[model samples]
Target: MIIDEQWIYCPVCSNKTRIKVRYNAELKNFPLFCPKCKQENLIDAKGFQIIVIKEPDAKTQSR
Candidate 1:
C-alpha cells in the first residue's frame, strides 16, 4: 500500500485540501483522511483512486 497525493474538499470548512491514500498493514481496510480537515475517510486499498465530489460554490462556503 502506498500514499497517493490527491486533492479533495474538506467537508467541515468546505475548502480544498490534500488527501492521501495510505495502506494499513494492521487493518483490513485502507485508512484515509483529509490533511486540512483532519477527517477520517475510509477507502479500499485495492480500489482505484477515490473521487470526492463537492457542492457547487463549495470554495466560497464558510464554517
Candidate 2:
C-alpha cells in the first residue's frame, strides 16, 4: 500500500494545502480546511489527479 501526499489549491482563496491519499482511498472525497480563507474545501482524487472542490456557502472572510 502506497500513500502519497499531494498539494491542493483552494478554489476560494487559492491557498495551497497538503492532503494524504492512499491507493485504496482514491475513490473517496477528502475535506480540507483553508486557514487563510477559513473555508471548508473538498479534495477529489481520481484518475491520479488532484481536484479542488469549493463550497459556495463555505466562504468566510478572515477577521
Candidate 3:
C-alpha cells in the first residue's frame, strides 16, 4: 500500500500549517486555522492545490 501526504499552507502567512491532507481528501468551504497567523481562512482544497475563499465582512449595527 502507498500513502500520499501533503501539508496545507496558510495563504496569509504562506507557511505550512498543522493540518495535513491525504491522497483521497477533498475540502470545500473549509475554515483553516493557522497557528502562525493566528487567524482562520476559508478555503477549498483538492489534490495539492488550495484556493482561498473570500468572505464578506458582516455589517455592524449602527448605534
Candidate 4:
C-alpha cells in the first residue's frame, strides 16, 4: 500500500512550513507555526485542502 504525503504551507506568507500530512489525515482548528514567516495561524485541513481560520478584529467586533 502506498501512502501519499503533502507539505503544508503558511497561509500568511505563502511559504512552506515544517508540517507534513498524509493523504488520509484530518485536522480541525490546528495551530500551525510558520518558521519562514514566524506567524501562528489556525487551520483546518482535510485530504489536501487547507483552510485558514481568520480572527475577527477587536475594534470591529461589537462589545
Ranking of all candidate structures by their lDDT, best first: 4, 3, 2, 1
Give the per-residue lDDT digits (tens) of candidate 1, residues 1-63.
Answer: 565434444545656656443333222333445666677544433233443433347788888
- Model 2, 9: alpha-carbon shift in Å? 1.4
- Where does the lowest 10-residue lDDT sum fall in candidate 2? 19-28
Error of 1 at 52 (Å): 9.3
For residues 1-63, what per-residue lDDT tens digits would candidate 2 score against the true structure? 554544556667777755545444574457877778887766777755767765555457454
Error of 2 at 40 (Å): 0.3
**Segments of candidate 2 deviating more than 4 angstroms:** 1-5, 18-27, 52-63
Candidate 1 structure lDDT: 0.47
Report the Cα lDDT for residue 3, model 2: 46
Q: In candidate 1, how many Å is residue 12 off?
A: 8.0
The positional error of residue 63 in candidate 2, measured at the CA in angstroms, is 37
lDDT by residue (tens digit), candidate 4, 8-37:
989889899999998899999999999987
TM-score per candidate, in order?
0.30, 0.48, 0.79, 0.85
Best by TM-score: 4
TM-score leaderboard ranking = 4, 3, 2, 1
Runs of candidate 1 with Cα error greater than 4 angstroms are 1-28, 45-63
